[model samples]
Target: MTFPQNEVRFEQLSTASPSVIYSIEEYPGRPARFDYLSPAFEEIYEIPVAKAMENAAIAFDTFHPDDLSGYQQAVIRSAKTMQPLQHEWRIITPSGKIKWVQANSRPERRQEGVLVWHGVMLDITDRKQTEAALRESEATKKQILKAIPDLIFWMSADGICLDSMPSNDAFQLFPDSGRVGKNLYTVLPPDLAEMRRQAVEKALQTGDVQVYEQRIMLHGGFYYEEVRVVGVGDDRVLVIVRNITSRKQAEIALQESEERFRSAFQDAPIGMALIGLDDRWLKVNPVLCNMFEYSEAELLTTRMFTMVHPEDRSILQQYIEQYLGQSQTKDKKATQVELRYQCKGGQIIWVRLNLSVVRDAQRHPSYYVAQIQDITQEHAVNRMKDEFISIVSHELRTPLTAIQGFLGLLNTGIYTNNPEKTQRMLKLAMDNGDRLVRLVNDILDLERLSSGKVQLAMTTCNASELMQQAVDSIHSIADQAAVTLAVVPTKAQVWAASDSIIQTLTNLLSNAIKFSPPQTTVTLSVQTQTDSVLFQVRDRGRGIPADKLESIFGRFQQVDVSDSRQKGGTGLGLAICQSIVQQHGGNIWVESTLGEGSTFYFTLPTPDP
Candidate 1:
C-alpha cells in the first residue's frame, strides 16, 4: 500500500524542481513497502515501478551491509516511538542499479499500530557533483599555494585564520607551521597582524578591493609582500600574497639607471636638451643651460627660438618644422644642422647641432633631442690657417717673379759676360724657385682641405695605373735621396677620386724618400678586398715615434720639428693626404717601428657593380 504523497507533490510541482516523491507503508506480517514512486525516482534509481511494488525486499537487499543497521535503527525508532525518521541509505533496484536515497518517514500512532513513512527524494546528484567540484577546486588551490615559494594565508573578517597553505620545507621558505584554524594575531607580531587586519577591514568597509605592501622580519632577513585583499562574501575575505623583495631590488636598480641618465644629460661635454612641441622647454640639462646662459626655470619660460641668433633664426625654424614633418613619416634620423646661436652674454657661438626626434605612442611628434657642440675654436684655427696660407703664397710669388725676370734677362744676354755660367746660374735659380712655389701650393692645399673648402670629384679607376703614375712622379725625389722606389698592385680597379688618390700617394712617397737612409728601398703597394682597396707606401727610414704617430697627419703636425729645418719643406703634405682620403670615404694611418721603417696606409672603397 502507498502513503499519501500530496505534500511531496506540492513541494516538487515546478518544472525546475528536482525533488521526487515516494510513499511507504508497513503492514502486519508483511514487510514495509512503497505504494507509489514519482516519475523522477524511476530515472534516479533506474528501477521500474511494477517490480518495486511486487517485492519490497528487491530494493533493501542491495544496501551496503555496513550501513544496514543504521537504516534499520532509523525505521524501527520511527515505528515504535511514532517519530519521524531521517536518514540516507543505498538501495539496489530490480534493474541492477544502485542509488543513494535520503528518506524521511513519519509513523502514525493509531489503534491498528501500522507505521507509514512518507518523504521526497531529491535528485541530489547534481548537488553532489557540485560539492565534488568544489572539493577538487579547493584541493587544486591548496596544491598551487603549497607549490609557491612564498607564504600564503586566508583570514576571516574577524581576523581568524580559516585556512592557510605554507610553502615547501626544502629551504624553510615559509617559516610558519600549524597555520589553519588559528587566530591571525596568534601567529604574527602585534604590529604586522594589526596592519593586515586594518587592510582587510578597509576592504570590507568600502566593499572594494584593497592592495597593500608590507615588510616582515623573517629568518635572519626581511621579506617584502605585495598583498591584495578582496571581499569574497559579506562575512569573508580572500588574500593573495606575493613575495616582492626581488622586485623591490629591481625597482631600486631602475632608479639608479634613471639617475645615470639624468647625470649624463646634465653634465655631458656637449650641450643637450629635451625640447617639447610649440618650442617649449621640457628639460634643459646643465650643459644646455650653460650654453644658453639660462637656469632651468628660465629656459622653461623661454621658447627654443630665443637662443637662436637673429640672422639664423628663420632658417633654424624652417629646418625645425621640416624635421618635425618628416619625422612623422618615417624613422627619425640623427640629423646634423649647423647654425649660429647667440648666448645670453651676447656672444655668437658657432654651433654644430645634431638633433633627434622622440615620438609619442601614436607616432606624433613629442619632443626634440638636441646635441650641440661649440665650434668657435675650430673656426678660429681655420681663419689663422688661411692667413698663414696667404702669407706663404705672397712669399713664393715674389721669389718666382724675380727668378723669372732674371732668367729672361740672362737668356737675352743682358749684362752677361760668360753665357754658359749665366745659363747655369739661371737654371739653378729656376729649380729653387720652383721648389718654393711647390711648398707654398702644398700649404695652401692643406689650408683648403682643413677648412672643408675643397670639393672632390670621386670615381672608380685602375689602381695599378694610379700606383704607376705616383711612382713616376716620385722617382726623381727617390733618385735624389739615393733610394730605390717600386710600385706594386694586387687589384686592378678601385673606387676613388683620381687626383686626390694621386696626391695622397705622392705625399706618402715624398715623406718616405725624405726620411729614408741612403740606398734604402721605398715600396708602394695596393691591396684590394671585397669592400675597399688598401694603398700603402713603405720606407726604410727613421720611423715615427710611437706616441706621435696619431698626430703626424694633422696640419702642421710633425714627428720631429727639426726635420723641417733640415728638409726645407712645408709640413702640410701628410695632412693634405689624410683630408683627401677622408673625402673619398676612406681612412689614412701609419704603422712604424723606430729606426726600421714607416708604412703609411690608406683605403678607398671598392667599385660597386
Candidate 2:
C-alpha cells in the first residue's frame, strides 16, 4: 500500500512513540482487518507488524482468553456510539508471557456503513503490579490494627484527635464515632486531658516516647490505663492506651494479703516464731519472747535449739530432717510434740510445739513456722488428779473391808455361839457401814459444791442456835474421845443456808474433837463483825503442823495420811466445810502451831439486825 505525504509524516511521528499505533476497519457482517501497526507492536506482542496488518486477528489472538470477550464488547459499544474508547485488559503474548495493557482510541463511521478505529496500546504490567502491592499492604495494616487490644490514635500535636483505629468499646473512653475532630479536652476529664497535653508536647520536643498511667472512672467502675505517646512527625503523634485494671487489682490484692499475714503473726495470742533451716530464730513475736523470759532482740540473736531443753533438742532436730526429706517426695504434714523449754531465768516449762515447713516456688523446704503453747499448769493438774485417785481408793477399801469382815463373822456360826460377841460384831458392821455412807455422802457434797451444781438456800440463822445444834450433834463423839465441848456463843445472826451452816459447824467441831486428847476442851464460839459473823472451833490437843494448815482443806488431804484410818476420818470433812463457807460468800482458814492448840475460823455474811 502507498501512503500520502501527510500520512507518511503521521506514521513517522508515531514510530518514535513507545506505543503500538494501530488502525482497524470493520465491515458489516465481516471480520475486522488491521490497516496499520507501529514498529513497537513487534516488541510488545512479539508479533511482526506485517503479519498483524494482513490479519488483525493475528494480534487479537494475543489477547488473554479471559479478557478477549470484554475487549470485543468494548469495541462494539465504542463503534455504535462513535465515541472515544478507553479500556484496560490483560493479554498473553506469542511468547506465552502475560501482560497488562491500556488502550485509547477514537472511532469513526464511513459512507458504506463501515467502522474504523485509530488507537494506541501501552504496556502497563509494572504499574498494575505496583498498584496490587499497595492494596495488599493496606489490607495487612488494617488486620494488624484490628488484632491489637490497645486503642490507637493519630493526633495533632495540639491534642486533637485526627484519626483513630477501630478498637473495643471497653478500651475507648468515649464512643468511637464522635472521637475524631475533637480535642482531648473535650473527650477526657480536665486532669487527664492536661496530662496527655503535657505528654504530647514532651514527645514532640524530645522525639522520644512519653509514657504515663491514669485511672478513669467509667460506667461506675474504675479503669486503669497505661498510655504511651510517640511523635510520628509532621506535628502529629500516635497515642496508645492499654487497659491495666486486672493487673493493678491483682497487685493491690497481693499487697493487702501480705499486710494481713504480717499483722496476724505479730499479734497472735499464743507464741509464734519463724525459724531458719539452721534452727536459728528468724523472727520472734512478743508472746514467744515473754514465754521464754527473753526480749525479742535477744531471741532473734540466739538459736531456737539453745532455748529448747537439752533432752528435747535432738528430737526437734530429727523432726526437721524428716519433714524436709518427706517434702521432696510428696506433700508434707505438720508435726506437733510436747517438749520442755528452759526459760531465761533457769526455769523449765512444758510447751506444746507445733511445727511446719514453708516451701519455695520449686517446692523445696525454705524455713519453718512454730506455734508454742504453755502447758505447765496442765501438767501440775494432771499430777494432782492422779494422787487424789490413789488416796480415795485406799480410803474406800478400808471401810468396805471392815464392814464385810464384821458381817461375815456374825453370819458364820463361830460368832453365833456367843450372843454378846455376835451383837458386838453386828454393831461393828453397822458402824463401818455408817462410816462408808458418810464417806460417799461427803464426796458427793464436795463435788456438787465445787462444780457449782448445787444452789444454796440462804436464810437468817441465829449464831448461838447454830453452835448448839452442831455441839449436840457431835456431843457423843466428843464424849467418846473424852474431850469436853464448850460453847461461847453470841446473839449474832448470819445470812446463810441454815442447814448448810449447821453442817459446817458440826464438821469443824467433829474434827476438833477427833484431834483433841482426853480431858482437852474443844470450844465453839461466834463473834459479830461489821459485815460478817465469824465462827471459831478451838481445841487443845495435838495441833496440826504449820505447813498443813492451808493444805488441810483440800480433798483427801490431812496432816497425816494415817488420819483417814486411825482417826475414823474420811479426809473430806474440812474440804466440805470450806466449800460451804465459800458458797455463803465467806472465807475459811485454820491457825495452828506444832504441839499447841489449833483453831478453825470461818465467816458468814451477817443479816441486818
Candidate 3:
C-alpha cells in the first residue's frame, strides 16, 4: 500500500491535474462501467465524482449526441489493437451545457474478454473558440484586400514580384510585362527599378515603412504613384502603390498657370505694378521699370510718389488718400486717374492709371494692381479733333451761305421781274446746290470706307476695257476742258470691283483733264506686272510739290486752294481712289516734280487662272 517518493509525487500531480483521469471496463452484458473517476468530474463535468464511479454510463451520458458514434468507434478500434487513443470531441455536461474536450487514453485487454480504457479528459472549449476567431479574422483581412483599389504586391527582397492582389492585374503599371516570379528590373526602367530596390532595402534595413512618389509612363499616358513599402517577413516586402496621377497633373497645371502669369506680367505692352497700401512699389514688371528707367530692385525700394511730376504729385496724393479711405471690396469697378510722371530723361509723360484692389482669402485688401498706359499721343489727337471740327464747320457754312443767298433771291419776287435774270439766278443756285451735294457725298463715302462697311463687288475685268469706258464717260468733259484724251492700250485682266475700279479711273481721268493745260494730253494707261496690273493717269500740268504729292491723297486734301476752286475739284478724288485700290490688295501713289507733269498710279491684283 506504500509507494516510493517519485511514485507518490506522480500520484499527487495526477490528482491535482486540471483534467479528469478515468477508466472504463467493457463486458458483454452491458456497454461499460466506470471503475475509477477523478475528482475533476464534479467541477468539469458538473457531476459528483462518487456518482460517476458508480457506473460508466455517467461518462457515456456526457458524450455529445453528434460525436457519440465517433467516440465509440475510436474506443473500439483502440481496444482491438491495444493502442493509445487520442480524440477531440464535444461533451454534454449534466447542466445541459456543451464543452469541447480532448480525450487522450491508452487501451489494454486483460484476462479473457475483459477490455479496459484509461483516459484523461481536458476541457479544450477555449482553444476551439480562439481558433474560430482567428479563422474569421483571416477571412475579413482577405476581403479588405480584395475591396481596396490600390495595387498591392508581395515582392521578394531581390525585387521579384512574388504575388499581387486583385487578380485582374491589368491595373499594374507594367500589366503585360510578365508579373509573377519576374524581377521588377526586367519590366521597369533601370532607374525606376533601382528606386524600387532602394525602397525595399530601406524598409528591410530600417525595419520601418518607406513611402515615396514615382512618375511613370504607362498605357500611352503619364502616371504617378504614391508607393508605400513595408517588410512583411525576411524575404518579402508589401508594396501598396496608389495612383496619384490626378493630383500630379493638378500640381503641374498650377505651375504652368503661374508661369503664364509671370510671362504676361513681364511682356505686357503697358506698364503694370503691384503697390502696397503705403503707396510703395511691391513689385514692378519690366514694362513699368522701363517706363521709369529704374531697375526692379531700385523701384521696389522707391515710393510711387517720387516718380510723379511736381504739379501732379498733389493729385496722386489726394487719390491715394481717397482710395485708402474707402472700404476694401471685391467686384467693384476699378478707379482710373490721369496723371503725369517724369521719366529719367526729364520729360513729363501723361499716363492713364487704373487701380484695382486685390484681396486675400479672408477678403481683406492685400495690395493694389496698377495698370499704366501712356496717353500723350491720345491728348494730342483730342486737340486735333477739336480743330478739325471747327475747320469743317467753317467750310460747310461757306457753301451754305452761297446756296442760301442765291436760292433766296430766286425764291422771292426779286428775280421774277425779268426772265433772263430769273434764269441766270436759277443757274447760280443750281451750281451751289450741286457743290453742296458733292460735298455731302464725299463725306459719306469717306465715312463708309473708313468704317469698313462697304462690300466691294469684286471680279476679273479687262484693264483696257475699264480705261476705255472711263475715257468715253469723260470725253465731253475732256472737250470742255480742252485737254486731249489719250490711252496706252493694254489687254491685261485684273481682279477688282468693277464699279469701284471704273469710278477710281474716272476720278483720276477727270482730275488729269482738269489740271492739264488746254491742248495738253491727259493719258490713261494700264501696265501689267507679274502678279498685278497698274493703272495710271498722267497729265501735262503744273505738277504738285514733292511734299504735296503724298498729302494730296488725304481726305479733303488739296494741292492748291485756288486751283481746287478754279477746277471744281472736291479734293476727295485721290483719297477715294486710294481706299478702293488698297481694298483690292494693292497700293496707290503719286509721283510729281514741281512745274512738270504728274502721274497718279494705282495697282489691282490679278485673278488666279
Candidate 4:
C-alpha cells in the first residue's frame, strides 16, 4: 500500500494509536520536502512539526557524502519507473549528533508529464546502527579465514562455485581445464566428477556435513585428499581439502611389506604367525593355521603358549621370554629363535619362529612381529634318510654275509670234497641273488612313485575278493610268524583297478603278519560304508606310537628303523599302498596304541548303484 494513503487512513481512525505518521514529496535531481508534517514528528525526532515541514533536506543534508550520489540516483530511477524508492541514510544535526534515517517513497505521474514522488520517512537510527556494526564484523571474519594457508571454498545451492579464497589449488587438482564460475560437475575429473557431484548434492539436500577421501589428479601428479563439506549461510557450502599423501604413502608401504610377508608366509613351505605383545597371536596365515589344524580366527584369539607341546613348553617358554625381553630392551633390538609348538590335534611341530618388535612413537613395545615356520616335514625326511642309510648298510651286509659264509665253507674245502655240501652252497648263493633282486625292485618302486611315473592298469573288480587274494598271498608269511591270519569278507563291490587294490591289501596284510606275535591272530576285515568300502588289517604285535602314525605311509618310513629290514620287508610297501589308494580317489590311515597293536585301514569307492 502507498504510505501516503496509509497515513491518511491512519489519521481517520477514531481511536488514536501511539504510531508516528508523516508524508513527504520527493523530486528527481531536487531535494525531498515534507508535504505533510504530523504533530507526532516532534516527539519522534525531537523537532517541531513546522521546522521539519519547512525543509526535509535540512535533516538529510548532514548525511555522509558517500551516500548522497547513490541516494540521488535511486530517486531519479524510481521517478522514471514510477516505482518505490527505499533507502537508509545517516544524518548529523547542527548539535554534532549523528542519527540514522530511513525513507520509502513512490513516484506518481502527473498530467503535465512530470513524475513526482510521495512517500514517508521515519527515523530508524537505532536499527540502522545495529545493522552497520554486524556488516563490519562479518568483513573482518572473512579476512581472517582467507589469510589461512589452506584452501577454503564455498559452493552455491546448485553446486556451482560461488566464492573461494587463497588460491584455486582445489580446481587445479581436478582434471577439468578451468573451474572458476563453473559447477562441480564441469570441473571434476571424468571418473570421479560424477561421484563427487552426487555426494555434494546429497549433502546439500540433507543439510549435513559429508566427509570422504579421494585421489585427485593434479598438474604435478595424483594426490590423496581428505575432504569435508559443511552447510553454511543461505544454503551455501564450505569445503575443505587436506593433503594426506605422506600418510597414504606410509600405509601403502606397510601394505606392500605385509604382502611380502604373506608371500613368505604362504609359499615358504612352512607355517608362519604374527603374535601380539602379550604373547597372543594377532594374525596367522593359511599354512600356519593349516599345520596346527586350527582356523585363523581361532589361532589369533589364543595365546602362543597354549599351542606349545607340553614336553617342549618349558624350554620353548624360556626362549620366548628371552626373545621378547630382548626385543623390549632398548639396547637389544629384535630377536629370532627356533622353538617347538604343538598342533591342535596334539602333534608336535618343530618351527623356527623369528620375532621382531613394532614400536609406537613413544618407543614403547606395541606388538610382536613373528614368522613361524614348521620344519616337521624336513625333520621327518632327514630321519628317513638316516634310516635309509642304515637300511642300505644292512642290505650291503646281506651279500657280504653270503660271500663270507661261502668263503668260510671253502676254507675247510668241505663243500668241494662233499657233493651235498657243494650243492647246499650253490642253493644259498641263488637265494642271496633272489634277495638282491627284491631289494632292487623295492628301490625302483619308490623312484617311480616319487617321480609320478607309476601308471595303473585300471579295471573295476570286487573289493572283498581282492582282500581275500592278498590274504592268501600273505598266508605263508603269517605261518612263518606263527600268527593265524583271518579274512572278514564283505558283500559290497567297488570300482577300482583290481591289481592296485590287491597290491595295497597285500602290503597291509604282510605288515600285520610280520608285526604280530607268535601264534596270535592277524585279522583282515572288509566292510561297506556310505560312499566307500573299508578294508582294515589289525595285528596282535606291538603298535606304533601316536606321533609316527601319520608318517608311517611315507616313503622309506618305518615304525622301528633298526628291525625294518630284519623283518624281511622293505619300507616302501606302505608308501606304495598309500599311492595306490590315493590314485583311486581313496585314502589310507592307521590307528595305533603304543605297546598294544595297530589297525591299518584303507577306503575304496563303492560301485555306482
Ranking by lDDT: 2, 3, 1, 4
lDDT tens readout by residue for model 1, 195-285: 8899889988888888888787877887677878888777777776777888887887899999999888987998887877777788877
Total clashes in model 3, counting residue pairs 3 or more apart in sequence or in different chains = 1
Q: Which tens-of-lDDT digit does each residue in 37-87 have in candidate 3?
A: 777767788988888778667777888889999987887788778889999
List the candidate numbers ranked by TM-score, top first: 2, 3, 1, 4
Give the range where candidate 3 is weakest over 10 consecutive residues by summed lDDT: 168-177
TM-score comparison, 3 vs 4, better candidate: 3
lDDT, candidate 2, 1-609, per-residue tens: 446987888878888878988878899888899877889888888988888888878888888889988988998889878889889899888778999999999998887988888899999999999999999999998889878888888899888999988767665665578889999999899999999999999999999999999999988998888999999996999998988888888888989999899889989999999999888899988998999999998888898888889999888778767767776778667878888999999999999888888889988778889999988998889888888788778778877888889887667778656989888877888888888998999888888999999899888888899889888998898888899999995888999888888899998888888788899899989888899988988988788877888999999888888887678788899999999999999999989876788999999999866
Model 2: number of clashes? 0
TM-score of 1: 0.49
lDDT of 2: 0.87
Alpha carbon deviation, residue 349, candidate 1 (Å): 2.1
Error of 3 at 288 (Å): 4.4
TM-score of each: 0.49, 0.76, 0.58, 0.40
Summarize candidate 4's per-residue lDDT along 493-531 as a digit string, tens digits: 888888778878888888888777798898888788999
Best by TM-score: 2
lDDT-wise, the better of 2 and 4 is 2
> lDDT, candidate 2, residue 428?
80
